[model samples]
Target: MKRKIRVLVAKPGLDGHDRGAKVVARSLRDAGFEVIYTGIRQTPAMIAEAALQEDVDVVGLSVLSGAHMALVPKVKEALVAQGMDDVLVLVGGIIPNEDVPALNAIGVKGIFGPGTATQEIVDFIHKELAEPAA
Candidate 1:
């Protein structure tokens, strides 16, 4: 049997808002993915540690504090430091359109903004993880 995909949903930085994160975590859980949700005010290192401990296949970050540019890179760095470079990283929040390319350049495979369908997020994860790595 195929192992279920494990995802670590995190709220990094000072973003106290977590309703969206909870929703995504719940949606992913309902979609048959194993999910771990780190609550609000988590640091990048903390998130990376959680991902490592959970042995997650993906790390989904929810940042609405306008700190994506700064925080995301740090999170990526932490993940890499922990030898989790192959793990899929995703971002969702009030991200600006102009920053999408930059985020992608830094290896964030998926970025979902407000109003994005939960099914789309679920499908993206399924497709991305289903494909063999290059």
Candidate 2:
């Protein structure tokens, strides 16, 4: 049997709207991935800490505050500090295209912007996880 991929869906910064995050979480759950959502108003530190505790295979960060450039690095750094360098980090929500490179450099390899299909996200995760480095 294939072990279900464990994923942590986190909302960072002051983004009060979590409808998108909730929908993503449910979609991932429906796709057979175990998902843990950190809810709204979570700091980068809290997100990383929860990721570590959950020992999740992936950390899907939903940031809409335009603070993604600032917060994403913090979460990645925290994960690295905890020796979780191998964990996959995915960013979803409103992100400027230019910021994708920076997030990519910080180990947030997957980026899903607005209007992306839920199945695409699921397929992307599966394909990425199958990669040698993931």
lDDT per residue for candidate 1 within 1-134, as digits (tens), equals 97989999999999699999999999999999999988999999999999999999999999999999999999999999989999999999999999999999999999999999999999999998886777
Residue-pair clashes per prediction, in order, are 0, 0
Quantify all predictions' global Cα lDDT against the true fold. Answer: 0.95, 0.90
Candidate 1 global lDDT: 0.95
lDDT of 2 by residue, 13-110 (tens): 99798888999999999999999988988887898899989989999999888999988899888899899999999989999999888788777889
For all predictions, the C-alpha RMSD in Å is 1.7, 2.0
Model 2 CA deviation exceeding 4 Å by range: 131-134
Model 1 misplaced regions, further than 4 Å: 131-134
Worst 10 residues of 2 by lDDT: 125-134
